[model samples]
Target: MPELLSPRIDAISFRQLRLFESVGRLCSVRRGSEECNLSQPAVTQSLAKLEQMIGVELFERRPSGSYLTPLGRILYSRVVRMLKQMVTALFELEVPGGQVGAEAIVHRLTRSQVRSLVAIIEHGTFAAAAAALQITEGSLQRAARDLECNLRKNILFRSADGVIVTPAGIACGRRMSLALQEIDWAINEIDVARDIGESRIVIGALPFGGSVLLASMLDEFLATQSKVDVRIATESTSEMMQLLRDGKVDLVIGLTQETVGDDLVSQTLAETPYEVVARRGHPLTGQSHVNHEDLIKYDWVVGMPNSNRRNCFDRLFIDGPKPRTPIATSALLFIRHLLAGSNRLTLMTSYELQHETMLVRVPIDVPLPCPTIGITTRADWLPTALHRDFINLIKSRVNTRSIMGVTRTAA
Candidate 1:
């Protein structure tokens, strides 16, 4: 909404947005004036400024009354949603409920304050945030203080350990971001309608299911859709969730258990078991019955420790002599290459090694944990039509022999 999620606090006036919402919903300037408690000229003037600011003629002036343009209809719907969420979050987040009411907060809180709080928390320091926001330290500090006061919560505080965004502050920042994402979503839709922007979906991937899911679905998705960009960002579980909350990553497709948030929803896509994979001609391949003893005889490459696959790897040698100096890494690509060129063995799922035709799954009579892979998204996320199609493709392409019907769980 404001230059790709920087809080467009400067570009948009909350009061103006509320006025826009009122006019669009009532479909008449007179009705909007009544609801907003403004004179007819004031409402009309505000609407003109808003349309000029967003560079879209939001309304077609009708002889009977005002009506939404095609783009106006899109922006208006999202703005209505954004305003509702702001009003609810401001009240429910335990602001002095009756004193500083939700509607008051919506009108009182400036976008600068919202953007400032988010930037401070995300950058983890005042100076860094000020630099990134290109604002004075005094201005940033004042914005944060004003925001904390409005919410009646201790957001940013200096402890002996330096600076910290209190859990409350973190929660507030997330809530603040939700509304901005709503606006950004509207802008994306506007771009699509004008045929001037590339439709992009940023997917968070784990080392697991996305590979198989993408291997099967990506080419087809691109072939069928035009001017679309699909990006996959692989990061630690925590980072991806942060990205999702910040509205950078649209949806995460991978190990879902590590995520914990009140705003996320997850759906199980596949449940896959771990396998001990090695080069086809490796010594373990010759054994019809592979045991921990035989596995320990060879060197091993491993996924990051404490992960389900790594736990299975660790248990393999727990009962007997452990392998000497097993390599530990979270990078599946490195592990895959290491497995083919050397006598290293590792515990990974069949879905991960589907493309590695030269690698053989050792016939190990061992009990291993099966990891559940799925898609996690913000509960209020507005997935575009293309994204919805891609998800449907995944649901249809990855099924039956993989996993049965999908189940959705919310925060």
Candidate 2:
């Protein structure tokens, strides 16, 4: 039987792929030239070479503007995925002693090579990307040629305006990147365990957690562990999620409630009671009894409006649309400062307010609804032994410490 598709894969140069990806992204020859810092003719030559190799026109040109052809569009999507994988690998390499060195020999891709792939994805022109790297476009072209020969596939497609990515190109980049990450992580796991009988675990906490329970618990946990490396970084709740997703840190301890998203796995760690606090002798403090009605009258310094705390506050005061005259909302420290210096009231978890000198809880008898704190990790990444141990440590602390002004047993 005759072969319906080409039995042999077409050859594509990495430079050509870079050039095509650039043209596809930028959408114009002149822009591609300016970005690549190449003479228009040079970019044209690269695109032409790519088209010749692929046996397809990857883009369509019109008077209004240039766009990818159907085939080209498919390729562009693939290229984007591939480039993301390449960038992910480079980010991993920044960590000291990742597995890239040993496994890289088999793939013959250095960190620079991985970065170059990303540059092509970002800038979309070989000349532009090469200029950014301070190397000759011809040098980049040669590198692509070498990569294509090794892969044995026409990884890039091209046309008059720019280049397009092929499915094969995208798949190869993604597979290679994932392989590199797993390898690096595996090596790190071994090194961490070998250095200590138990692996040294790293935890990233949100600013709220950093200032309160997490800080005290971290110190106690480290004291108990003879061999462990624990790192605590303060960031916003959303940023903590990103770090966990990327596996840059083992677990996140914060006020964020867990939700199922792309690759994230959330476990409810605890519920923290919240309350409104104000400076001593403030108007709310003077009231014989504090009530939600009176509490809403003052401009509150609150968590960001969309956060669970703020959202709950909104619901609590739902009868009257949050009297928009003016209210303050910010991260914990700003709220703390406002509460310390002025009569401005702010809502905080009991743990956060425990150490403050100037702030006192209002007399409102209602239980300020609590926000759930949780630990999250990428769903695809199974928790390591060390990761589980760190989680247990958090649970133990919650069991002992007062998160919402009451001990765990009482709550």
Query: lDDT of all the models against the reference?
Result: 0.75, 0.59
How many Å off is the CA of 279 in candidate 1?
Answer: 1.4
lDDT of 2 by residue, 1-411 (tens): 011111211134435555667788888866777776778789888887765554556778776545777656545555554444554443443322344432333234444454455456546778788998678988777766665544344566786866644555544444454433442343234334445234445577766644476776777777766766566666666766766654556677677653448767666666677777778677766666776667767777666645666676776677664533254454666667766777677677776666666677776755667776767666655454566766788777674245645322110
Question: Per-residue lDDT for 25-64 in model 1, tens only?
Answer: 8899999999989999999998898777666788999889
Maximum-lDDT candidate: 1
Q: What does the lDDT read for residue 345 in candidate 1?
A: 81
Q: Which portions of model 1 show Cα errors greater than 4 Å?
A: 1-10, 60-67, 88-92, 98-100, 158-165, 258-262, 296-299, 311-325, 399-411
Error of 1 at 356 (Å): 0.3
Error of 1 at 175 (Å): 2.5
> Measured by C-alpha RMSD in angstroms, how accurate is candidate 1?
5.6
| TM per candidate | 0.83, 0.57
